[model samples]
Target: MRISDSMRLDAIVRQQGHLKEQYANASRVAATGAKIGAPGDNPVGAAQSVRLQGALDRIDAFRESIKTPKGDLDQAEGALATAGDLFARAGEIALQGANGSLSATDRASLASEVDALKTQLVDAANTKGQAGYLFGGTSTATAAMDAAGNFLGNAADRTAEIAPGVSAITSVSGALAFSASGGRNVAADLDALRTALISNNPAAIAATVSTLDASRRQILAARTDAGLKSNRLDTADAAHQQTQLSLAAQRHAVSDADPTTAYSNLIALQGAVEQAISVARTSLSTMSINKFG
Candidate 1:
């Protein structure tokens, strides 16, 4: 049962090295406030933190995507409201023109107002939003309606992804909102009313009263659709906000060190390191004495 000085020295050196490594790691955790600086420190927690961060990033992207579409829907809604008001006034003009008692001069003057309303409705149909034309369907770069009351846009619906698997319609179809595609051609109806008033035709003017009402209803329906899309965007954004907050909390739990616990560990490791160095030195001194004697 012989004990060697070299063997004792080697064991002391190994023990000191291990204590120094632990002290270094604790110091980094305390100073940086990160429990998992590298995957080796806590592999499972580091992996979880990565996944949570990816989810947070996706939520942020989805929220950003909602912003432009929501603005487009608001502008579309406002344009439709303006169109509705214009149609209402046109309806009133039609009613007044339908009266047989009105003089020819009076009907001619009412025709002027109908002309103005028709122009305004065209302007509303051609409204541009953040992305492009509001009622142009997917063909948003150009005007939705031309000067002669023809629909310049297609009937396609533009859509955007509001959530992972959820898509929402963001663009309105001018062909449906203002042309015969929905029920009647709104601009043509205005033209008929104006023509009836100018020619002093009692029966034609009376017919426009019903046509104008139908056009107004079409605009109202389009407006309702825009409002519903806006509500869906709001709901999706709220969900994204909640998800981002939850993901952040989870990431913090896995990645961040508790300040108090980190500092306490650092202090404890520092003491252990100092004690290990002292023991190493004492062991080396005793070995030197034994060898020299």
Candidate 2:
């Protein structure tokens, strides 16, 4: 086969171009300190890095969503504890008022104290936190209970996703905490006890003692539930942190390049390109001399 000088020159050009491209790739990797600058470099690793980054972002989002609700639930548990104490105190006062030996004036004074306790209980039910009223269920934008001790919130349980396919309830039920369904309304019970005390109705006061005890038990139960939810959130948060750490490590492994190795590779490619250029120049000079002679 006869080879023309033009063909030899074209082959030299092509070889030089390929060498330059290799040197450029190594330089880019070294300068940028990345093993995979583009998807074409390591297609599988690039795709995996993208997926890991997306998972990490989702975990961050879930953490952000859980923050306010966790605080709100904590406040709800605290409020329920306060409410329980108030109900217990009310029960004590009811027992004292039930005594026949106590004078009517003493009973009236006790009734006044009970009214104050009722007000405090109302405040507990209306407790607000980061997301507004903690016990307001899904109606967290407003107070959970009114001054009259009437539950202003609905029956919806607020929830948040802590992980994939796992949800945690983040709101307390005001109705259950204040006035247990099919049971006595704690606020109304306090009112009845006060009215009974003022009227010196011993039987009604005795009845209210049992009702107050029931209300206290209900509040305790709700508080227990709140505590469990808070624990779930804590567990989920820890797991989320672990997941984020894992995703971060995977992404680093997939995309991050060792600077030392990259620099070494770059130096080797530079040397090879320099050698190829020298050899190409020598060959071209020989060809030119032969063609002219």
For residues 24-83, what per-residue lDDT tens digits would candidate 1 score against the true structure? 889899999999989998999989989998888888998998999899898899999999
Leading candidate by TM-score = 1
lDDT of 2 by residue, 1-293 (tens): 99888898898899889989988988888888778899999999999988898999999998888888788778888888998999899999999999989899999999899889988988898888987777777888888878988888888887778887888778878877776562668888888899999999888899899988988898998999888888888888898999999899889888887888888988898898889889888888888666776
TM-scores for every predicted model: 0.91, 0.86
Query: Which pairs, if any, clash in model 2?
Result: none
lDDT accuracy of residue 264 in candidate 1:
92
Model 2: lDDT of residue 48: 92
In candidate 2, which residue ranges exceed 4 Å CA deviation? 1-12, 99-101, 201-203, 278-293
lDDT of each: 0.89, 0.86
